[model samples]
Target: MWQNLDYVSERRADTVMVLSGDHIYKMDYRPLLAYHQEKEADVTIAVMNVPVEETHRFGILTVNRQGRVVEFTEKPKERDKGTLANMGIYAFRAGVLHECLPRYAQQYSDLDFGHHVIPTMIAEGYRLYAYRFDGYWVDVGTIQAYWETSMALLDPDSPLQLYDRAWVVHTRSYERPPAKLGPQARVARSMICNGCIVRGRVERSVLGPGVYVSPGAVVRESVVMNDTWVGPGAVLDRVIVDKQVVVGAGVQLGCGNDVGVPNTTYGDHLRTGITVVGKAAHIPPNIRIGRNVVVHPHVDEEDFVSYGDEVPSGETI
Candidate 1:
């Protein structure tokens, strides 16, 4: 991404803004750019105050009263430092970046902004400032965080309000037919996106585009993505079904009390009692998949023969 510095210089741009794609936030960058101009900053990083205990997951920084960044650490193990976290958003002077990126490439083996670039800039006495953001911003970098953030959207009092017209968050959407609910369908506190056809019970869940839930299917506390088919009598609880998956009839996903068992492969990510089914997987009928199970992408129905109808908790298929 640092290679874009050359394009910035070629375009004769005064400054360039860098943003991460995996984050969900509503912000007006105009104010931040104005603050950067006012401070005559060589680089301005957007920082937010997270809990000190959670600082280990982010690029923590210390700033003076004038908002000048003094120190920067990326994902430190001992996180007793400040809670100001780098939001992976930066505004850099075009000339400064065009000048420094090549020089830093020779100095450091890694090109990470948090680990190498920003720290080196601070050490070299560059005029770096921090723009404080107190609004709703979430770095959904982990599976647990993504699930939690998705669930948070259902909250009526959530900080991230999608219905607000003041600052609308737009996305590239496909042209699809409107979502339909059958006469027997029962849905509560869930978001059924366009192109969905529901005839089952969905509570406290989010269904993406083109999903079809057959009758007698019960999806609770789950996130089902695009083009997935929930078969009849299938019960999904605290599960995340990826795009184009086929949950067979009478399959009980996220079942059993063994929620403590973490996934065998991605234990750190799937330990929170959430079973994950990757894209295009075909789950067999009447299979009881326990908590924290991981169904890999493109898994065929024949692949479940090894499990013999019951996939125990924490197993990956």
Candidate 2:
């Protein structure tokens, strides 16, 4: 890992920090690096304590009381043995990175850091410190977890508050003004972002950039992503619309009435029949999409009778 880093370091003259894309976490690495330099450790890994049920999915770390790492195991069954688990965020000294990567490259012949590099460094008796992270860390790797995590942003008591000006969560900017609520709009317990024109009833839902809810449309407990158009009188419940999708007039995305009939188009991914519409997808006019159905991307078709069937429109589906 270090040798290739050395090569890249020469090409680009700046410090590099490795971050994992899967987890929704905010960590301040400046303090960790300062501590690393103060302690003069070879490597410093950020660690957080997750619930026992979730430990099997993460790399667990055992550290002594003095904050020294003693052992590292990947996905241990018994999480009770160690409370500290790796957060996959690292801060390495440039010299240490140079020394570690070449040796790692020779053994593994690949540039995978977690699999071979970190473990070998720990075994080599280099001083390693555990930087404890006490903030909110949500690994939204699954569909259910992703939905829940996004909703958590609306909670007042949520630990991960994106609205905090001091530690703001950043996303790409959209070319739109502040979200507008039309005279006919009735919104309760919902989050509406910029460029959205809401003219209907939105409850417990998240409307992303450029979403247009026509008059009399009712959206409840659903997530509508960027540039989605919810037609007039449409009723959506527990649905997840990806970027640039469109729902036709009076369409029902989830099961609001009967229970025995199943909406198999949503598949078994949804534990509680939450529907998901893929990016830039389109639904036909007056279609009833049953509970937990997932509509794929770039579909632009009309007059669909069944649930879970991908829309035939090649551009909007």
Question: Top model by lDDT, which number?
Answer: 1
Q: Write the per-residue lDDT of candidate 1 for residues 29-107, one digit (tens) a residue.
A: 9999999999999999999999878888889988999999999989878866689999999999887887788999888
Query: Could you tell me which residue pairs clash in candidate 1?
Result: none
- Specify the poorest-scoring 10-residue window by lDDT in model 1: 1-10
lDDT of each: 0.93, 0.75
lDDT of 2 by residue, 269-302 (tens): 5545566788877787677766555567776664
Off by over 4 Å in 2: 1-7, 11-16, 109-111, 256-269, 302-317
Global lDDT for candidate 1? 0.93
Clashes found in each candidate (C-alpha, N, C closer than 3 A): 0, 13
Cα error, residue 41 of model 2, in Å, equals 1.0
Error of 1 at 136 (Å): 0.9
Q: Which stretches of candidate 1 lie over 4 Å from their true place?
A: 77-80
lDDT of the structure predicted as candidate 2? 0.75
- TM-scores for all candidates? 0.97, 0.86
